[model samples]
Target: MDVEKLTKALQWRGFTVERFATAAEAADWMDQAIDGVSVGFGGCLTAEQMGLYPRLSAHNRCFWHWQGDSRDDASRSDVYITSVNALAETGELINIDGTGNRVGATLWGPKEVYFVVGRNKVAPDFDAALWRARNVAAPKNAQRLKRKTPCAVRGDRCYDCKSPERICRGLVVLWEKPTAFEKMTVVLIDEDLGL
Candidate 1:
């Protein structure tokens, strides 16, 4: 996708955008981005796999995760920082997670949210973002976690099913930039970061 177009569209949708040259720079900013944040992480291999989490972890307290391995404490900290998978050009965030930790935290518990997205996660519109979440994001995650979801078996797209193990159950879209905190920054990197 065209990064400039995507960035412009996101900006119009109400997020403050910062362009980074590389994933390293993105990770660096995330580390120094804030303080005392109750960070919540979605199942983003890009952030975790790229080694961004450790650096961000060093800065402040991570929120208590309702799912995934409980690595950080959630009660003491008031501020929150985290990343999600999908973002539309119109400035809406779309996320699909199995255990609900990713979407759950963003919905109600965070003081602020920071989404670190690479060029790959940008879609033309909200519907396109949803398509990417199901077809591109979900199945790849299923394969990574070794789940038996239909998309995992088909390796094509999401059916939006009633399966108990369906990862796409809780989808949250932030159409307006959140004003709950001092800042809600969406750092846009030119590189490919998440699925």
Candidate 2:
């Protein structure tokens, strides 16, 4: 992947991009960046892989519904942290969310939003990014959740199934930084961290 090109594109599109050699380094940077702030976490495997919940919770009021915390409260936090399913090198971010909370918070209602993206999530272009989200990320997520969706059981690409257990009901493509947000940062990690 052309990391430099991607970083330049993201910057041109008004996103603050920070590249890290590893997820741990990025997590450490995040821990310091959001110190003393009220932080909220969306359902992000990347964040979990980085061990951010415990690190952030030590210094910030961090809420993650995946840990049985209140989703409503997390949505209203001072800052929102999450990961996208795919990030286009051309500067588009693709995310598939089962519930609207993750995408909703990403769109608005936060002072700042931080996206923790691993190198494996980057795609060559927008179409490829969307494809990655649907075919790769979605299936892996469904399998991880132990859902009975066709994608999970079939062990292949998305069938666009009508199963109620589908975790990809909402698709979001963030081409530019939201005008309502005070800041939007994309932390790019070198290692592959999550599905």
Candidate 3:
């Protein structure tokens, strides 16, 4: 991936971009950058991969529904951290949510938002990015959550099925840093960290 080009594209769109060679580096940087604040998480495998919760929680009041905290508590926190399903090199960020909490917070809730992205999630363009979100990320997430959707059963691409367990119900595309937020930062890591 063209890290410099992607960085420029993200920067041009008003997002503060931070590049790192590894997930651990990014996580460590974030742990130090944010302190004593209530931090919330959107269902993020990337953060899990980096062992982020424990690192951040040592100093920050962190909430994650995946770890027994309420989703509402997460949404109401001072900062929100999550990963994108797909990131277009053109600078658009894409996320497919089964529950609205993740995308919803990105749109308006937090004082600041941080997206932790790995190289695997970056696509060449908008079309490729959306395709990755729908086909690659969504299906993998279904399997992880054991949702029993067609995509999960098939262990492949998305069927765009009508199954009630479908995890692709809500799609959010960030063309730029959202207007209401104080800031949105994109933490780009070069390794393959998550699905």
Better of 2 and 3 by lDDT: 3
**Cα lDDT tens digits for candidate 3, 93-127:** 99999899999999988899999999999999999
User: Which pairs clash in model 1?
Assistant: 38-79, 64-74
Kindly report which residue stretches of model 2 are placed more than 4 angstroms away from their true locations once superposed.
none
TM-score of candidate 3 against the unseen true structure: 0.98
* Higher-lDDT candidate of 1 and 2: 2
Judged by whole-model lDDT over C-alpha atoms, candidate 3 comes out at 0.94
User: Model 1: residues >4 Å from true position, as ranges?
Assistant: 36-38, 63-79
Candidate 2 lDDT by residue in tens digits, 1-195: 999999999999999999999988898899889988888899999999999999999999989999889877888999999999999999998999998899989987889999999999999999999999999999999999999999999879999999999888889899899899989999999999889
lDDT of 1 by residue, 69-112 (tens): 46234322354445566777767888876666666656555566
After aligning candidate 3 to the native by TM-score, how far in Å is the CA of 119 from where it should be? 0.2
Higher-TM-score candidate of 1 and 2: 2
lDDT of each: 0.69, 0.93, 0.94
